[model samples]
Target: MSTTSTPDNLELATTAREMADQAPAGSLEKAVAGSVAITCATTRTYQEAIDVLGGIQPVEVRRPAIEFLERLAVAAR
Candidate 1:
């Protein structure tokens, strides 16, 4: 895990947390948001989240999740 907490990182983490909180429990969206929240809140690089998200089966979930993860990856840098 990295400790590089930039403004972008903080914002992304906040967004992830919000998404996790808003998504229905046991939903794929919730799972994705939770993974992203964990990654960002812990100040970890986004690759782990990316890898986990890649396994998402539903196109509806995977599409937006990947988009969010990409933004997170950029912010994590």
Candidate 2:
């Protein structure tokens, strides 16, 4: 399998890293938010790279970001 990173994903990762760094301490709320953002960024990077490979892949690739985002949304509730 091959993997390639895209500029958009890199930007997302950068933004997520920034958000994580600035997140408030000790609060479950903040932690969840930060975690979600980070997850999304990481997921995007992974997905884009995997997509470039153009081969059969695990089902996880189809929904990691969505699943993580949903979890994060629910946690925020």
Please estimate how well model 2 matches the true structure, expressed as its whole-model Cα lDDT.
Answer: 0.44
When summed lDDT is taken over every stretch of 10 residues in candidate 1, the lowest stretch is 1-10
Off by over 4 Å in 2: 1-7, 44-77
For model 2, residues 35-60, the per-residue Cα lDDT tens digits are: 44555465555454334322323333
Cα deviation in Å at residue 70, candidate 2? 11
RMSD value for candidate 1: 5.2
Clashes of each: 0, 0
Q: Over 4 Å off in model 1, which ranges?
A: 1-7, 44-66, 71-77
Candidate 2 accuracy as TM-score: 0.34
Clashes of 2: 0
